[model samples]
Target: MSTHRILIAGFGGQGVQFAGRLLAHVGMYVGKEVSYLSSYGPEMRGGTSNCSVQISDKFIASPLVLEPTELVVMNGPSLEKFEKTVVPGGRIYIDSSIVAKPAVRSDIEPHPIPATALAEEMGLGRLANVIFCGYLIKKLDLCPLSALPAILKEVVSAKRPELLEGNLQALALGFSM
Candidate 1:
């Protein structure tokens, strides 16, 4: 049982906090001790947003993540701000469609996923976060794939029940990538 500290960052509308929550929930659902913490600016859509998630087999001491073991960045600014925070030999997931530059560190593993472009191709641009979620789970081996659809069903709103299937599809697509 190892501990994982993850940081997800992007603009407000990019679902950075949502991604963090998804990971934390999945960790808890799988019987791991998990903590999720998030911060965002006043600007609703374009403001900087970030979340920290910690998962461990034992009790978690704190929710704060000063140095992340894993990281996901949806845009250039987030990449710049958080790339150095990733621990050496850790993994960094980047939304390649939005972030033009690569991480400066050479020790960490970088996975560049074209999430926005993939979402656009799927005709559901808003599903990029879900797709990234799928990719992250597969990359990190966080939880069983079967667990995600149930989690999606739980978190997705009743008002937009129609999106459940699409989100699942996006998740599958991302996992396959």
Candidate 2:
């Protein structure tokens, strides 16, 4: 009901930027105020990367999120970097297969999702961030379920209709977890 800020972090090429973009696009589709931003340096895929998306029923004033309602980390480094900054009672999603440890605090809820593994199982290894997005959506309850399939269909490959199905499967899997 209130503004929701989300931070998606990982090494570059992990689809963190795309994840944020997709969420922002979905927010736009639903007639919500949305902002998306990403960081890209020389290191790119091998180095740290971050993307933030803010969606709200009211106006969205900024794209940066130093404190987010939810945080999604694709690797250990991102998990560590954002763990301390997540707002209290916030949700954090980690790729459990890649990130072994969790935050020292217990107040912040952490969802350990084997997103990469699930994507691999679904034959779409490139969709790890999308899978994580599904989990983040499920955990945060930020958007309507009815809008998700439409979201994937709009943002993902139309050429590979199979991918849209796989992404939906991944989204459902995330919700189930």
Instruction: Using TM-score, give the best candidate's number.
Output: 1
* Global lDDT scores for all candidate models: 0.84, 0.81
84-149 per-residue lDDT for model 2 (tens digits): 888999988888878888667688987888888878887777788877777767666767677788
Candidate 1 per-residue lDDT over residues 1-177, each given as its tens digit: 578998888888888877788788778788889999887445335578888899899888888887998898998998888888888999999999999998889999999988999899989768788888888778778777788888887777879999889888888887778
Worst 10 residues of 2 by lDDT: 39-48
Error of 1 at 85 (Å): 0.8
For model 1, give the 10-residue run with minimal summed lDDT. Answer: 39-48
Where does candidate 2 stray beyond 4 Å? 41-46, 157-162
